[model samples]
Target: MSGKVFLAGAAGAVGAALTPLLVESGYEVYGTTRRLERMDAIRAAGARPVLVDIFDRERLANAIDCIAPMIVVHQLTDLPPGLDPTRMSDAVSRNARIRGEGTANLVSAALAAGCECVVAQSIAWAYAAGAKPYTESQPLDLGSEGARAVTVVGVAALERWVLGVNETGGVGTVLRYGNLYGPGTGRDTPQGASPLHVEAAAWAALLAVQHMKGGAFNVAEDEAEVTSEKAKREFGWLPDMRLPAQAAQ
Candidate 1:
């Protein structure tokens, strides 16, 4: 909880919720945003702001090297605001690229920086269609057509790269979060399948970074779509938690 922690995608919804948590937890937080305009927001959240694109391997590596963080958090995504239906197809493709290629770059950067652990964001709804409450061991829906197929493939690649890095000495933890709602995210209340608060999603990442044992964990409410018992037992995490009033703004 007291290391120099580097957070990728730190201007995104969950990232915005997480920055203050990391700072409050006494971590020397370095938050990243691709847009230079977001540096002030990151800084205001009590983190050192870094501007680096996840697609730019060299810049990301340099940023990580400069920060020398012990923990690296991957929250990168390219989805449009409110998940605009008209733009969803393009967003899916872009987001998949972020998951696949962006994840590769982040892993390489973390490894080069000698990071001890990496905590990454993933989705809970990617499981194959047979289960009620899917666990971490369930297979992803790899055979689906169109957008789902793209997402599943991208997710598989991201998980493989992250978990594989553990063999070389860096521990990897993946938090498969349910659909996020709450502040900064478009939804203020639960809406879709396995609805999760954005602050809860951020809390899961914080728990994963602090206490995970190098494997995937489902992070959701006590609903039937996904199970978060493992995260609760292992990290003592609770999904109902919210950020402070100031941070939520």
Candidate 2:
């Protein structure tokens, strides 16, 4: 099942973790990054670097069209280091825009390229107050206010756009990752409910791309806040899995 893969946000935490896995699995990867400085890092991970902002529809479309990958992976995000409380007000809006508009653009480019599958990053903590452990069937917290509302709305848009690819004969898989920690995430230890390591999140995306399954799955630790049974059973994902030291760099 190896073929070309277009990875968005290649310089990001999860993206950096996922790139080597894709290459080692025999997929030719083209990773996207907005910064010229990160190109070498993507190359080091064995993926060709593509410098294009997700908001630039023309360049994004052109890049994807030229690559014409079999799968598209979206690991894009916008958040402050350590999720500093002081900067969160503005960061929340920016992050929402990334999840909403950025995801929309990526999906559009993917569909235009006739990609077979699209694997996207989402969050596991967005579920509304409900049972202790939330599942993929659980509804998102759409009725929240202020920052929470903004985040939920953006998440909804992202999931909708990604899942809608199925209507056009393409597979769409969303991994609802829990609060991430570990290298490059600015946290060395787990924090918050359903804590997940960055490597595990990356592995989940790889599994989705390999399985080419459509629908959402919660990618998180075996905790009470969210249930990861779906992902474990469907994708054989291991929440504690970490990338090999050399690959993680």
Candidate 3:
């Protein structure tokens, strides 16, 4: 029940937004990145930055130990610049591995550190074909083939790790965010499946630490592929998230 957070991928878009929120929420936040140079802004946002690669299991675990956080947020991804779709074929594979192997490493660290809660970032488009606006109870298309199959494997692995985690120390809440948009985000609303603003996604993570139930909730607008009613009812997830007026200036 202590207010300490270990945040991975702290230099990324969602992490940047979340850092300030964690501080404002009265939680002591520890942020991590692969490069110390990328962490200055995170420090400015009131997080103690630790530079280390998430793929390095020992290094990641040691960093978690040093931080001694009660909560861990897994938002790690290896997206390249410009949100370029041209290179998606390659990026998709890489991202899948992160969701699979990377998630396992994070889960292990969480277990070792005896963290209480784990809130992870996941995609909303992986639900198997159903009526529409797929619910959390719906099945994921893990049986997909080709590149789509590869993507599903990653998504399933990430979620499995996040939701399958035990609740003794803490529970893992998998927030299946819609395609992210808004400030500093790459994919716009019209371009992806059940798109949500980046600010909203960060807000979901912030609220997850405080109010989310330990389960999977879709966080997105009322798009055709997924439904966020659970998040709306449970964590007050806002698909229509926005920037504050002063910050928008």
Number of backbone collisions per candidate: 0, 0, 2
Which regions of candidate 1 deviate over 4 angstroms? none
> Best candidate, TM-score-wise?
2
CA-only RMSD, every prediction:
1.1, 1.0, 1.9
Give lDDT tens digits, candidate 3, residues 1-249. 248899998878788778777777788999989986887887888898888887899999888877778899987877767687787789899999989998999888988888878999998888888788689999999778899999999999998888887545468899888887765667555557687777788889988998746999888887537888889889776676664554343
Output the TM-score of candidate 2.
Answer: 0.98
Better of 1 and 3 by TM-score: 1
lDDT of 1 by residue, 65-165 (tens): 98899999999888778877888899888888988999999998889889988889999999998757888888999999988999999998889888887
Q: What TM-score fits each model?
A: 0.97, 0.98, 0.93
Better of 2 and 3 by TM-score: 2
The better candidate by lDDT, 1 or 3, is 1
Q: Could you say which candidate leads in lDDT?
A: 2
lDDT tens digits, residues 126-211, model 2? 99999878989989999999889999999999999999988899999989999999888888999889899999999999999999
lDDT of each: 0.88, 0.92, 0.82
